[model samples]
Target: MHGEFWQLDNKNPDAKLYYKDHCIDYNELEAQVQQAVNSLPSERCLIALVAQSTLDFVIFYLAALRQSHVVLLIDAALAENDRNELLEHYQVNLLIEGNKIHSLSDYTHQLADELCLLLSTSGSTGSPKLVKLSKANLVANCSSINQFLPIIKDDVVMTFLPLSYSFGLSILHTHLAMGANIVLQSDSPMSADFWHNFEHYKVTSFYGVPLSYQLLNRLGLEKMPLGNVRYMAQAGGKLLARDWQLLSDYTHNNNIDFFVMYGQTEATARIAYLPAEYFSRQIGFIGKEIPGVELQLLDSEGERVEQFDSQGELCVRGSNIFGGYSETLVELSYFENIPLLHTGDIAIQSPSGLYQIVGRSKRICKIAGRRINLDELQSWLDALCQFEVVCVGSEDEIVVYSEQPIEAEVIKQLATKLKCHSRLIQTIVLEAIPRLSNSKVDYHALKQ
Candidate 1:
């Protein structure tokens, strides 16, 4: 039986999936999903599915959902210990690792009826905390995204991001919900083969994070064959203002829509988006809340912030919000309807009603009796150096990690900008900035 989340039965039979020159139409895809479903246990149980970017992964994921089994998506490349830890902690009944399905335990799980999917809060950090999502959450999010993004049955999307990541998973959920064709590939955007597939399949929509867009810009995006491209989107983290402007100009000149979005795993995928028409004018803003979602800004006392340009904590209320978080097996059986999700993101609203994230509430540190927003500081340093940099610190000192070594003179300049003693800042050079599978900076690794 098809899952209530995806309308596979209603999809056009001609809409197809292309993987390594092999194409399967929607009807055949459904048949495969049904066949995979037969491999899973008939009884509802907790499953830990390793999300690899492959056609088999897609089939198994949909199969698990089809069988009404609660699935916890784990990264395929996750460390063995971490992977085993999750299986043990969640007391998973079954584990789908690649093509092999291992029965980890025969003990039945008392998972919440509404809990359909569990995603890690951060794909990079092996945090045991998983975001609990219901079928309603996924369906609501897919509908909200489709309302803004012009995805149709004729559109073709390439899957370059890990299916374990929320941003990447949302792409799959949203496109399939619309009956849009998906092209599965594991190649990075920098690869010629990736672009070759893009051109070969006439892929229309593309999605990436800040780093992806930056790399594309360096690769001379304007020189690439983008004539068939319909739109491109960026999220996961803030794009530097300069990079945003560059992409905005490039997409506009090419008659391609460039979407700047803001979201979290808690909200399923998207919370707000800056429409392409407003891209040039609102370069740094996240635009506005998506359809059927409500965004509120609250001050430290929890009172609503009314003044424009005033910073407040962004809280979201929508059906797309996750059911709750599950840190252990016991938590899996419990479901709390969270009416409001405190994003813990500090933001300011422009006079035109656009919202821009200023910094994360927990990303603040006091150094030399001065409060510093690490995100803001990192953005400033990034714009100054024209490259990405990471900032981490305690009350005592701030450490700056960069791929390239910053000269002592530049350090002095940073100190001058911060109006603090030079001793408070230290620079570390690394061959590369550690990034998670989703292209997000690995702050946990850098901290270690």
Candidate 2:
């Protein structure tokens, strides 16, 4: 049997999808999906879907999955060269770009029946390394997320994040699974048009990365009209403790739920989430693992870490864990059962069983015989400067970037804090921090 990841057919027919001023109910959406499905080749093929946050994207995505086609969701803003290179390398049989669908290849490559979706690991670079996920992975994650978030039929959500990104895709999956209304738009959250639609439709929920929340906070979130907003979720990266507290206070005072989530693309979307009730107590902790997901901290020796407040690489085991990585046609023909996903993130578990990410295992650098965690340093710098800061480093030195100019004294103080020479630390001021379309910091762009 072909696995239907999203059971759109079973959803309430009256649930609406708002795009511009037009609204389509779930029954009409199902009909459109069927029409799109009928147009595609019946054989299982790798389809490259240029995912934009629009009604067409949603309809086509659901249609492709319903037909049991392997879909490679691509960012709509991906560079043409990068996009073409990926399409060729993967031997994609079909290309769905906007309202048009093109037959790219006639050769049908054999694919595992269970393999359903392929997503790029990085949003900025359009990395060819794709995470392979099956229908079970998507359904497990959606159910896990739904178990925690209080979504209802009347709830309205705005789709601002690209549907290609895992975190963004999860929002679409969980919302649609609940038969809730979704407002599809490609407009930036900074735009007046976005806020206009948000207020007009009475959008109840939205998700953002750390950078999005930081920008919103800067725009004076308290001053904005948020009467309909029931909750705000943050993921994609760690929101600084200071920023987390600021948001927690705002959400608490405003009677809105604030969820601090943690996950990677490999886990299909979310691994753990800080419940809104615990937000005030746990400022920087990623509270607990989502339902049906188990998390463990493993040391370099691959042994489970038992001590509280000790750092270890975070590991996840769940039905939601991706099948494997696929960079070639042969890799897609067979499913690799990866029962445990090593997240590459260093985390610490508190005595109360809450987990907080400290840094990435690869984000560490040594200078002057001392090891430094770039994430820790960045957090320190952010708190010190009271602004957004990004830290990247080599073996000899750490370079910090900030949108606002930092005083020389601050650099000197940071060096003193790290017990390193002032020359080893350098600061650069940029008009803005480089970010991906998903609003996560683009370290690749910054390094360039």
Candidate 3:
């Protein structure tokens, strides 16, 4: 009754995990993980994971890795066809689903050089890039992040997002490293059980995307019984001025730390985070480099720019960076200490020694004769009405699309708001915009 992160501690018999009705000791979960691992065919195992952040998912994931099997993490929100295609393309010989793993303690192991985990990424070119990260990558990154964030043993964490995303993965790794408690709920965030679970479990921390905070602000969290969350971190995307303004005030008044983190899947989840103490004044900043990491900014000539408040392409060098991608035919390429990961993001170093993500270089377009950053424009649109607007370009003109098309009056209003010439911009309304497998808007596909 033991494996992976936590060994079975039947001797202690005192460690407990909370459930609505009863508490489960560490022995039960440890036994479950070991049994699951023993039952599976461990050699070269490539399987799809579909657990909903429940105790079952956590147990199965740890068990699979404990025995050194390759696992593919898929978001539950992914269309079934895309999920199937991902597995099929990799020619994964076995598949694992459901909360229950058929109990068996019989399995084989022959992996001293085989791959362990295949993580899919949306490459800069708008295609799926599969990176093969070993147990080493996951374990190392987890340990490093834990050093900076003093996550106490069994500290309560509320996980409201999908586990497949890299940001979510970091939460899993760090928690497991400290044997922390995760309060899992399978309902929508708006449900009564959602907040009740946090309060009941006595959650102290949580992570969210920018949209999550924006939505919470719109819903007005003044009356929500969140109990006491000691910290709330934001990642996945940028939080604009409107949401940041209210969130900063709320967290400050509540005496809670608000962490603003930034990273990519390439870095195994996170590379930087802003300490909660620095907020309100410079809301978009993503703070300093995470522990065991260094950052630099380079232009087209690949020279470092050292001046404060200067903009350039951001680069990161860190141990958390994942190893190279796995090939379909089979050949392993390991990652070394690469000096830079040229993030396509445009960033600026502030006077007070902080980093702020201004916009993505890929999203900038020339509207008429002037260069306009789409992300910057979108921020203006959000302030006006919280509308999600994406701007793309043609050879000579720029096209802006939104779910609810803005009226002629709205366009004029936006022009006044953004200080842009009205005639040069074209606005259209569409029922939907196509996104990639990873849920990022497919600007390249939109190119005609």
Winner by lDDT: 1
For residues 1-448, what per-residue lDDT tens digits would candidate 2 score against the true structure? 1113356767766679988767899888888888998998887888999998888888899989988999999998899998999888888898998779988878778898789999987884778889999889988888888888888878998988888999989999988888888889978778999888889989998688887787778888877768889998989988877778788888888899988899899999999998888999887889899999999999999999999999999999999998888877788998888889999999999998999999999999998888989898888888888888899999888899988999999988988888999999888889888888777888889988
Cand. 2 TM to true fold: 0.97
Clashing pairs in 3: none
Note each model's CA RMSD in angstroms.
1.8, 1.8, 4.5
lDDT of each: 0.88, 0.87, 0.68
Model 3 TM-score is 0.85
What tens digits encode model 1's per-residue C-alpha lDDT throughout 1-448?
1224344788866788877757898888889889899999999999889898778888899999888899999987688998888788878899997778998988878889898999997775678999999988888888898889888788989999888999999899887887778999889889999998889889998899998888888898877777789999888999988888888888878899988999999999899999889988787789899999999999999999999999999999999999888898889897789999999999999999999999999999988788899999998888888777899979988999998887788789988877889999999999999888888888888987
lDDT of 3 by residue, 41-160 (tens): 746555667645677677778777777666777666666776667656656555566564432223332323535676656522312457666666566567666765657665777776
Clashing pairs in 2: none
Q: Residue 432, candidate 1: how far off, in angstroms?
A: 0.4
Comparing 2 and 3 on TM-score, the stronger one: 2
**Once superposed on the true structure, which residue ranges of model 1 sit more than 4 Å away at CA?**
1-5
Cα TM-score per model? 0.97, 0.97, 0.85
